[model samples]
Target: MDCLPLHTLQTVFGFHAFRPFQEEIINRLMAGDDSFVLMPTGGGKSLCYQIPALHRHGVAIVVSPLISLMKDQVDALRENGVAAAAYNSSLGERDSRQLLARLHAGELDLLYVAPERLMNDSFLERLREIPVALFAIDEAHCVSQWGHDFRPEYVALGRLRGIFPGIPLIALTATADHQTRNDIMERLGLADAQVYITGFDRPNIRYTVMEKRKPFQQLQEFLGTRPDEAGIVYALSRKRVEEVASKLRELGIEAAPYHAGLADRERSRVQEAFLRDDIRVVVATVAFGMGIDKPNVRFVVHYDLPKNIESYYQETGRAGRDGLPAEALLLFGYGDIPISRSLIESGTNPEQVRIELHKLSAMIGFAEAGSCRRGALLGYFGQRLEEPCGNCDLCLDPPDSFDATEEARKALSCVYRVGQRFGAGHVIDVLRGSKNERIRQLGHDRLSTYGIGAHLAAEAWGSIIRQLIHRGYLQQDLANFSVLKLTPSALPLLRGEERLVLAKPRIKVAEAKKEPRRRGTVLNMEYNEDLFQSLRALRKRLADEQNVPPYVIFSDATLAEMAALRPLDSEALLKVNGVGVQKLGRYGAAFLEVIRQD
Candidate 1:
C-alpha cells in the first residue's frame, strides 16, 4: 500500500482517495510515461504530480511561470509533510544557493522553478548531475500562443524532451480549447502523451453575469450581501483598480489594489496579505490572479469584461478551489466590448487580429446570451452539457423571449436610413422622431423611418440595439466612433425573409433570492453557525501562531466538516476530508477540543 498512490493521497494529502483522473495520471507517471491533464481548478491537478514525485526515486522538477505560485505550492507541499522548495527571483543569492544545494543533495522531493531557470544552460547542466525523477510543466496552456496567458518562455519547454530524454514529462492546465490544446501538445512535444480531458464544469461555482449599469453601485450591492466573505474584484486597468479599491475601502470594506504598475514589494505584500486573509477583497487588473493559490476566495467579480472567454474561465476558476461553493459575477456593457475589440484589432498580424476578434465576439455573445450561461461558456471550450445547468443566473431565472421581427426590421431601416454612419443613439433618436437640435441639424427628422419606433421607449430601443450587435445582425464600427452598421446577416432580417426573436431586457436588478445553502457546504447539513465561527477563530489563531495561512492548516471545508460531524477525538478528526496524518498530528487536538466542547 505504501507504493500505492491512494495510500499517498490519504497519508499525505488527507483525502480518502484520488480525485477523478488523479490516480490514472499518477499511475502513468509512475510507469515513466507522459501525460496531458486538463482538469478544472479544484479537480486535484496538483496531487497528480505530487504523488508521483513522492513515489519516484529522485526529485521532481516542476516548471512554473510565476514565482508567487511556485512559493504557494511549495509551501502547501511542505505543510503536507513533503520536502518541497522553490527557486525564483524572490529568493536571495544565499537562499538560492542553499535550495540548490538541497536539491542537488536529493533533500527536496519537488523543486519548483520558472521556465527561464529551467531552460538556463547552467541550471540544466547542474540538474544533469542529479537523479531527476520527472518534469512537470504547470499552466501548460502558456506554451500555446493562442492560449490567453501565453508566455514566450513557455515555448522553451519543447526543449525539455531532448534535454531529459526518457524522463516522463506531464503538462497540466485548467483552461484550453481544442486549438490551444493541440498547440500545447505540439509545443511541448507531448503528442504521444496520455491526454486526460476531465470535464471543465465547476459545479460549485454559481455563474452570474449582470448588465453593467452604475458598476460601482452594482458591485457595492453585490458585495453587501456577502459580508466578511473573501473575494477578488477584477477591473480592467490600473487606474480603475485603484478607483475600485478606494471605493470599496471608502464603503468600509477591507480591500487592496494590485497591478504590475505597483512596486514589486508592494504587490508581493498585497498578495501575501490576501493569501493570509488580511484583506477581504482585492481589486486587481489581470496581472494579479494567475499564480494565486488562495482556496477560500468566496467569489471573483469581473468589474469589467475579460479580454476573452478563456481569460474569463481561468479567472473565475480561481474561486471555490477548496471544493466549497463559490460565486463568479461578471459585470459588462456594450462599452467594454469596443475597448477589448480595439486591443485585439491593434495586434500586428492580420491573422492574429482576426483570431482575437473572433475570440472577443464569442466572449460578447456569452455576456449577452439569454440562454444557459454555463452551457454557452462550456460550449466555447468544446464540451457539451446535456441539459441546462440550474446553477447559473439564466437557468435560475429564465428570461422571456418575444418575436421582434417587425422591431428588427424597423431598427434595421433606421440604421440604413441614417446612412449607416451614425451610432445607436442617433439611430434611436431618428427612430423616436426626436426634434432635438442635433437631429434637426442632421435633418434626420424628415427621413421616412423617423417616428417609426416611437411606439417603443428609448431604453427599449437601446436593448434592441445591443441585442442586434450581439446577435450579429449588426456590427458596431468600433474603429469609427461606435457607428451602427449592418452585417450581411441583417440583410435577411431587414427584407422580412428571416424572423427575429429577442429577449425582453431586464429593466431593474433581479430581486436577490435567498438561496438555500449549497449541498457541498459543511457536507450539506445545517451546521451550527456558532460552532463554525468558533472553529474559524481557532484556525485563525493557530495559523497566526504558525505564520501560515489558515487554509494551510485546514480549509473551510475541513472546519465545516468538523462543525457538522462534531469529531470528538484524533481518530474521528482524521476521518474528516482534509485532515491527514501530518495535520492530525499537529493541530488535531486543538480542533478536537473545539468540537468536544459542543
Candidate 2:
C-alpha cells in the first residue's frame, strides 16, 4: 500500500491513526472503487472522502445538500491548507467565474456543489471536459424515499454513476435504518459498492426523557446547570421556536430564533453569531441544524417531541460531536402525539403516510421504553446491545417499579370492551367512568369495565396504556384514527398466564449530579480549568481577527490537550494531537505563548 495517505493524515490533518474503517475506505477509493459508508455523526466520515480528494489525480466533486454545509466543509479544508472551494448561489458571478477557471486549470483539490447544480445539463457538459477524480455524495440518506429527510433532487444523483463510470463514487450518511440503507444503495446505483457500517452507538451523550410537566420550567432547570455552554433547542413549529427564544432571552440567556419564516439575512446573521459563540443558545424549528458544523455544542434539548426516531437521532447526534461528554434532554408529552399524527396524515401520498405513521409509532415506543434507552434506540436500527448502556437516565437513576399485572389487564380489557375501535383518550375515559357525552352516546358507561378503573387517575391509566403499546400487548392503527387494537401477545396477558412489572409514572425531571470525568481520548488528560479558559480566550481573539469560526483555528479538544500537556515550544506543541504542520506553522507560537505564561 502507498504511504502517502497516512503521511497526509499526519502532516496535513494532524491525526496519528485511522479511525476504524477510514484507512480501508480511503484505500478502496484510491483503487478506483465505489463505496458506501454508514458511520455515526462524529465518526470522521468526512476524512474518508477528504483524504482521498487530496491524493486523487483531479479535483474531487462533492455533492452536498445544503449551501451552508458546503461552505463549512470548504472553510475547514482551506484552514487545513487544502485548495477547496464551494460553487453555490452565495458566490458572486465574478467569484463563480474564478472558481470555474480554477477548476478547469486543476488548481483546486475539492469542489463542493449542491445536488441540483451538479445534475444540471450545463454542469454535466462542463464536467465532461475536465479531469474529475471522484464524486462524493454527502447526506446520502436524502436519496432514499424511506429516509426521514427525503429530497427528490437527490434522486437525480443516480445518473452520476452512468455519466462517470470510471471515476469512483462514495455516498455517506449518519442515520439510516435497515430499509433506508438498502433503499439508498438501490437508488444511488451503488449496488456493487463496498458497504461499511461502523456501528450506531454514541456513548458519550447521556440520554434523558422528562415527563414534560412544566416544560419551560424543566428547560430552565436543565439550562441552569450549564449557563455558559452553547446548545440548540429544537421545536416542531416556528411559533413555538420564537416563543421559546423570547422566553430564554427574557431570563438573560443570550439566545436567538431561527426558522424558515425568518428573513434570509436575519437567519444568516443568527447562524453566523451562533457559530462564532456570540450566541449561547439557538431555539429553532427543524430547519436550523441540518447545515451547522459547530463542534462544541454541549447539549441539545427537544422542547417538543420529534416526529420519528430518525429525526430524534439525527437531532440529538448534533451534540457531543467532538467526543466530549454531552446531554440530550427530550420533553416527552402525550399531547405532542396528536399534533404529530395530524401533520403526518395531512400528506396526499398514501404510502408515504403509512411509512411515516409506522415511524411515529416507533418513536413513541422509544420515548416510552422501560429498558435501557440506548438499547431501545439501537434496537430500532437493527443492532442489539447485550448489556444496558450505563449512561442514560434510566441507568443513572432507575425508575421505581411495581407489579402492574392488574392494571395491565384492566387497560387491555378496556381496549377490548370498547370493540378495539376507540383511541387511547376515549378508552381512558371509559376506564375512569367519565360522564362525558361520547361515553354516554356510545353506551360505554353500561359496560362492566367502565367504572373498574375509576379509582385510578386518568394520567396513571395513560401511562399504563402507553407501556402496554410499547411492550407489544397493544398496537395502534395510525391510519384509522390511531385506534387501539389487541395483538396476539395480549391474549396470554389477558388470560392471567403471565405477570407484568413496569416503571411508575414520573412527573418531574430528575436532576443528575455531576459525574467524575472519565478518560476520553488519549490526550484527554487532566487540565487546569483556568489555563484552558485562557487558551480559549486567545483562540477566540485569533478566530475573530481571521473572520473564521473558532473551531476552524483549533477545536476545544485540542485546547484541552494543550492545557494539559503545557507544551512550551514549537517542537513540543507539534507533538500534540490536532496540531498539523500547517496549523503549527500558523497558530503554534500564539498558543505556546499562552501556555508558557501559565
Highest-lDDT candidate: 2
Q: Over the stretch 181-251, how does candidate 2's per-residue lDDT look in tens digits? A: 99899988998999999999998899998888888898999899887799999999999999999999999
What's model 2's lDDT at 193?
99
Flag clash pairs in model 2. none
- lDDT for model 1, on a 0 to 1 scale? 0.85
lDDT of candidate 1 over 484-572, digit per residue (tens): 88888788888788898777876433422557756434666656778888999999998889888888888888888888888888888
Q: Which candidate is the best by TM-score?
A: 2
Worst 10 residues of 1 by lDDT: 505-514
Model 2: residue 102 alpha-carbon error in angstroms: 0.4
Q: Model 1 off-target regions past 4 Å?
A: 401-514, 517-520
| lDDT against the true structure, each candidate | 0.85, 0.87
> What is the alpha-carbon RMSD of candidate 1 to the true structure?
7.4
User: Distance from true position, residue 133, model 1, in Å?
Assistant: 0.9
